[model samples]
Target: MNEADVFTMLRDTILAVLIASGPVLALALIVGLVIAFFQALTQIQEMTLTFVPKIVAIFLGIVASLPFIYATLTGLSDRVFDLIGRGGP
Candidate 1:
């Protein structure tokens, strides 16, 4: 592949990675923030309190987003394989 084609593949790879992980990461961030707020309001500073909610939220987010993640990865894999099959220039 030429430089432009290589760059395009690189961009698509990054986008696919983001699409695969974005939901879980965003869920963790949001959950962590919410837990921090609640802790500040209640003055209940328990380390486990933050851990549990964020973990659960991240897990649920991953489960919910599995299909979308699968599709994105599959699409990326197909494109890469197709490029290989065509004897990439």
Candidate 2:
């Protein structure tokens, strides 16, 4: 592939990854921030307190967003395959 093709592929790959993971990452960030705020308000500085809720929230987010994520990945894969089939540069 040429330089432009390589860059385009790389950019597409990164974008696909971000789209796939965005929901879970965003949920984790929100949960972490909320937990941190709660901890600050209560003066309860427990490490595990942050971990469990974030994990649960992320897990729930993944479950909830599974269909959207699947569709995005499938689309990306189809496009990549189409490129390959077309002998893309």
Candidate 3:
């Protein structure tokens, strides 16, 4: 493929990754921020406190968002396959 095709593929790949990860990453960010706020308010500087909640929240978020993530990835994969099948530029 030429530079344009390579760039387009790269862009699509990055966008797919971002879409797939967006929900979990957003949940982690929100959970971490809330935990930080709680820690600051109570002065409980426990490392495990932050880790556990963030992990749990992110896990749940991933589980909850699995269908959406899967659909996005499937669409991207289909698009990539279509490009390849058509003898990508």
The models' CA-based lDDT, in order, is 0.93, 0.91, 0.94
- For candidate 2, write residues 20-88 as lDDT tens digits: 999899889989999999999999999999999898888889999999999988988898899899999
Those runs of model 2 whose alpha carbons end farther than 4 Å from true positions after fitting are none
**TM-scores of all models?**
0.92, 0.93, 0.94
Q: Any residue pairs clashing in model 1, and if so which?
A: 1-89
Q: Model 2 residue 80 lDDT?
A: 87
Model 1 whole-model lDDT (C-alpha atoms): 0.93
Worst 10 residues of 1 by lDDT: 53-62
Expressed as tens digits, the lDDT of each residue in 9-44 for candidate 1 is 999999999989998898899899999999999999
Candidate achieving the largest lDDT? 3
Q: Pick the candidate with the highest TM-score.
A: 3
lDDT of 3 by residue, 1-89 (tens): 69999899889999999989999999999999999999999999999999999999998999999999999999989999998999985
The candidate with the higher lDDT, 1 or 3, is: 3
The TM-score obtained by model 1 is: 0.92
The reply for model 3, stretches above 4 Å from the true place, is: none
